[model samples]
Target: MKKLKELFTQVKALNYTDGEDVSDLLWQLICYSPKMPVRLQSQQLLDEATSFTLEVDDSHFSHSVLKFNGFIWGNGKRKVLITHGWGSKAADFSDLITALRTIENLQIVAFDAPGNGSSEGELSNLLLFARATEVVIGTYGASDIMIGHSLGVMANIMAISETAIKPSLLINITPMVRLKENFTATMTFAEVPQAAQSKFFESFESLFKVPVSYFKLTDLYTEGAAVKHWLAYDPGDKVAPLEYLQEFLAMHPSVLSKEYAATGHERIIKDAGLINDIVELVKQGNKQGN
Candidate 1:
């Protein structure tokens, strides 16, 4: 709990007016700080995981970069692309990558988004994320499964709409069509002060090293018009409202919707049962030629 509180404190203090400077600070703190227990925990997690090879690809979209880590599981005949959420690195889903490796003929690729992890670029909105995915799919020439978490899920939806790249299955973990609730919950969870919240755009600009106008959340939703087949997993939690999930389902009936009782937004990914269910769904979709 103390460590969680420290993380909350650090999140609350995130300055957005000068994002490049803030990014430098964040890098220094994450890479070298001894006081950050969360960083230590993350490092420990990474150290325990099986290492993969890093590959870099330039994005066709300006101000964007793609950095992916490939983990060849089994025969590597089938490929799966997994994307992480905001403020998360590609290695955050290492557990999932490791577990999926057990299945033969499956290859796993996890990419760090433009603003996060080792990827280069200033902060990017959902459109840029979609474009990055398009570039990855076009470069690889594969249409396997695509799994996304939180904001990454939103980007995936937009990407499918904007690009011809279609995967056999689209799995969204704790996705939200609108981000207002997510922002509210994040602020509450991080205990961000009202004053800080008022300066959110400015702070985000600084934190992401992007222009304030580029942080607009609505643009991402507009670009999400192309998603038809999808799976949405929403736990009864504060991060995303049931109404939001329902709205997404209503718009896309082909979406496989499930609700967990106790699993919150973050834990839903860690749930083995949920993962198995998703894997099964993908297999079913493949069998049905979906």
Candidate 2:
């Protein structure tokens, strides 16, 4: 983390002659993958011998296709797909996966999104993440539940709305409600020039092909989707604001939410009780669906 901070600090100190290039560079830095490796114990659960791949359509770079890497564990009747957040790989859900493995006849799968982990790409966007989730669900063909954290929740919601794979239950942890809000915060923290902020937004929109207005979490949930949602979050999260979740729940009364005191954005998954609760919810939803 210190190294990453230093790298960003150096980049921020650079004197760029071209403002457009600087904006592009900033966007690239945001999109660039900071690959997270799976721990030894977590790697043990993964069936590295058998792997899966998907082709991601990269529209920004001449519509090129990128490869996405993933692994599947267990061969149970019910399927649970785990999606990690920004700059996070599938194996980050090690603790959750360890708990879920005990559930009988439950198949668990996870993947590294394009430009993340071992995936083939240099840059990624929300669309690519959504498409990757969709592809995994489509291929698996029997996803009963989905567990997502932060940006993973955003991708899951987008994939659920856009694709045919609607799971029985969705467990969203520390979900990012608004991309524009996040971007604004990021710019403020990075100390990006006021003149460069607009350029960054414009460049981002052009590169990702999605307007900032369309990036809200509320916009991703479509009515009549046969999915019961559980939202778990901590108000103290530094990256994603808890007020966003509050605002979303206000508008969408059908969703259920739970709050933890100080789980923050990243460590919520580390809670064993929370993982067990998620498993229990999935079981209940599976029974209800059947």
Candidate 3:
């Protein structure tokens, strides 16, 4: 982290120099997904699950084959898939995972996104993460529910939209909205030059084969869409603020929404009350399925 901060300093200076190509460095900076340490609480749940891997040809990485680590707990009725956001691993959802089990002896599947947690790849972007999600949903039946936090919400929605794989419910915890605005904020944090910003987007679009504008959350919403959404988020979340969600909320005012406070963005996924709501929603989904 210290080394990366030093590089950030260098990049900030380079951002001012005329005709300097900081795009490569900036690309690497943005793609670099830092892995968080697994908590002791999460470690116990992780140890109980059967560990597996899926070898994928990630086109975002020039069709490089990468092995992604996954975990599945329980062996009974119904299945639920849960995923964490950027810089987070499957184990981070330990508390929610435990509560979910109480709803049913559900075979819960969770995986670390490429370049995060125990997964392979040195760098990751939304395209790569969404691809991983689509692959996972393709392998496992998208039957009961798909639960996600932050960027995981984006990836989950992207996967379902691309594959047209319908889960019983889509539960978003601190869901991310407004991609272009968020990207601009990220560029500001990275100290990327306005000149280099355009270049970075060009490189991103080149690698992913789609402009950044192509990844809108609104794409998942349509008239008479069967899949339902249960959104739980704090209004003041700095990472994905209420402002970012305004457009989506305006478009679909009827989607099940829950407001939270003091939970912040990152830690809200593990909130006990939030988990209770998730369980309740899943219970309702199960009943509807039956």
Which candidate has the top score in TM-score? 3
Off by over 4 Å in 3: 1-7, 223-226
- C-alpha positional error of residue 202 in candidate 3 after TM-score superposition, expressed in Å: 2.3
Worst 10 residues of 2 by lDDT: 16-25
Give the lDDT of residue 242 in candidate 1. 71
lDDT string for model 3 (62-154, tens) is 468888998988875677888789788899899888888787657899999888898898878777778788788778766467888988888
- In model 3, what lDDT does residue 35 have? 77
TM-score for each predicted model, relative to the true structure: 0.64, 0.91, 0.92
Global CA lDDT computed for model 1: 0.58
Q: Which residue pairs in candidate 1 collide? A: 16-202, 16-203, 19-206
If ranked by TM-score, best first, what sequence of candidates would result? 3, 2, 1
Worst lDDT 10-window in candidate 3: 218-227
Q: Backbone clash tally for model 1? A: 3
RMSD for all candidates, in order, please: 6.7, 2.2, 2.0
Clashing pairs in 2: 76-105
Whole-model lDDT values for every prediction: 0.58, 0.78, 0.79
Please give the distance, in angstroms, between residue 31's alpha carbon in candidate 3 and its true position after superposition. 1.2
Candidate 3 lDDT score at position 179? 66
